[model samples]
Target: MDFEAMAEYLPLYKDAALLTLGIGWAGIAGAVVIGLAVALIVHFRIPVARQICRAYVELFRNTPLLIQLFFFYFGLPRFGFSISPEFCGAFGLALHGGAYMAESFRSGFESVDRIQRETSLALGLTPMQAVRYVILPQAVTLAFPSLVANVIFLLKETSVFSAISLMDLMFVTKDLMGLYYRTTECLVMLVLFYLVILVPVSLAGSAIERRLRYGSFGN
Candidate 1:
C-alpha cells in the first residue's frame, strides 16, 4: 500500500469530497421540493395530476439511477438541449431521489389523522393554508427519519457521477489510483472518507428520529 502517495493526494480528495457533498445536498433539497409537491397531489387525490405523479414515481424508482444520469447527460444532448455535466448529475440525482422521497412523504401524509384536516377546514382555513400550517408539519416530523435515510443513500450514490467525469470523491480516488498505481491505498482512503461523512450523518439521523419520537421538538 502506497500510503505516501495517498497522503500526497489528500488535498485533492478533500476538495472532491466537498464537491460530492455539495451536489448531494443540492439534489436532496430539490428532491424535497419535488417530493412534497407529488405527495400533496396524491394526498389531495388531484385527478390527473395524482396519476402523473404516480407514473413519475414508478418510472424513476424502477429504473437504475446510472441510466437516468446517462439519459440527462448523454441522451438529452443528442437532441437539442445541452446541459453541463455537473448540472446533469445534480438534476438526475434530484429526479431519482424525488421519486423515492415522494413515496416516503406519501406514507407520512397518510399517517397524519384525517381529523386534523377537518379541523383546519372548520377553522375557515383555505385548503392550501391548512396543508401548509396543519398537515405538512406533522407529516414532515413523521417522515423525517426516512427522509434522512434517503438523503444519505443519495449521498453515497453520488459516486455514480464519476462515470460522467464529475470529479467527485470517487472520481478523484480513481484518478489517484491510476496515476500512482496504488489501488489498495486509494480504495481504503475512499472508504474512510465516505465513512467520515456518512457515519456522522447516520448518527444525526438517529438523534433526530429519537427527538421526533419523544416529542422533544415539542411536536
Candidate 2:
C-alpha cells in the first residue's frame, strides 16, 4: 500500500465524489419527472401514451444498464445524434432509474382508493385538480420508501458510469490503483468512500420511512 500516493490522490477522489453526486442527483431528478409522468399516463389510461410508457418501462427494466449506456454513448453517434460521455452517463442512469421508479409510483398510485377520485369529482373538482390535490400527495407518501430505495440503488450504480469515461469516484479509484499499484489501499478507500456516502442516506431513508409510516413527522 502506497500511503503517500493515496494521500496525494485524496483531492482527486474528493472531486470525483462530488461529480458522482451531481450526476446521481441529476439522474434522480430526471427519474422523478419521468416516473411521475408515466405513472399518471398509466393511471389515466391515456390511449397511446400508456402503451408508450409500458414499452419504455419494459425496454429499460429488461435490459442491462451497461448495454443502455453503450447504446447512448456509442450507438447513437452512428445516427448523428452525438452526446458527451457525461451526458450519456447521466441520461442512461435517469432512463434506467425512471423505469423502476415508474413501477414504484404506479404501485403507490394504485394503492390510493378509487373512491377518493370519485369523492373529489363529486365535490366539483376537475380531474387534474383532483389528481394534483388529492391523489398525488397520498401516492407520493405511500411510495416514499420505494422511491428512496431506488435513489440509493441508483447512487451506487453511478460507479458503472466509469465505463463510459465519466470519471466518477470508482473511476478515480481505479486510476489511482493502476498508477500506484496499491490495490489494497485503493480498494479499502473505495469502500470507505462509498460507505461514507451511502450509510447516511440509508439511515435517513429509514428515519423518513418511519416518520411517514407513523404519520408523525417528528411533530
Candidate 3:
C-alpha cells in the first residue's frame, strides 16, 4: 500500500489538517450564533423579523452550498472587493449551514410547552425575556445533538473550499497523492483523519444528551 511513501507526506498532511480545523471551527462558531438568533426570531413569531428570517432560511436552504461558495469566491470579486478564498469559503458555510442549523434550533424551540409562554406573559416578561430566559436554555439542550452533527458536516464541507485554493485537508491530500501517486494510502488516511475528528464529536454529543436527560432542568 506504499505505506513508507505516504509517511513521507506527513508535513503536507499536517498543514492540511491545521487549515481545515481553523476554517471549520471559525465558520461553526459564526453559524451557531447566527443560526440561534434567526431560529429564535422565527420561533417566537417576531413580526417582520420573523418573515425575514423565514425568507433567509428558505433562500439558503433551497440553494446548493457549492453554488453559494462559488458565488462568494468567484462572483463577489466583480464588486471590487478583494476577499481571500478562505474568507469566501467560511462566509459561505456560515450563511448556508446557518439556515439548516436554524431549523434544527427551531425544532428545539417547538418542544417548549405553550404554558411556559403563557406563564411568561402572566409574569410581565417581554417576549424577548421569555426567549432569553426560558426558551433558549431548553432549546440548546434539544438542539445540541443536531448541532454536533452539523459541525462534522461543516468540517467535511471545508473540502469544497479546496476548489478555491484554500489548501485545506482535501486539497493537500490531493496534492500529496498526485505527487507521490499514493492514492489508496492517502485516501484511506483521509477517511481516518475525518473520523478522528468526527468520532469524538459524536461521543461528546451523546454524552451531553445523556447529561441533559439525567441532570437538572430535565426536558
Score each candidate by Cα lDDT.
0.90, 0.90, 0.83
Give RMSD to native, each candidate: 1.9, 1.5, 2.4
> What's each prediction's TM-score?
0.94, 0.95, 0.92
Off by over 4 Å in 2: 1-3, 217-219
User: Which of candidates 2 and 3 is the stronger one according to TM-score?
Assistant: 2
lDDT of 3 by residue, 81-107 (tens): 778987887788898889988988998
TM-score, cand. 1 vs. native: 0.94
Q: Write the per-residue lDDT of candidate 2 for residues 83-166, one digit (tens) a residue.
A: 998788889999999999999999999999999999999999999999999999899989999999998999998989899998
lDDT of 1 by residue, 1-219 (tens): 767877888898899989898888889899999999999999999999999999999999999899999888889888989998889888999999999899999999999999999999999999999999999989989999889989899999999999888999889888877887788888898999999889999988888888878957443
Q: Stretches of candidate 3 above 4 Å error?
A: 216-219
The residue pairs in collision within model 2 are: none
Cα-based lDDT at residue 127, candidate 2:
99
Instruction: Identify the runs in model 1 with alpha carbons over 4 angstroms from their true place.
Output: 217-219
The TM-score, computed over Cα atoms with residue i paired to residue i, of candidate 3 is 0.92
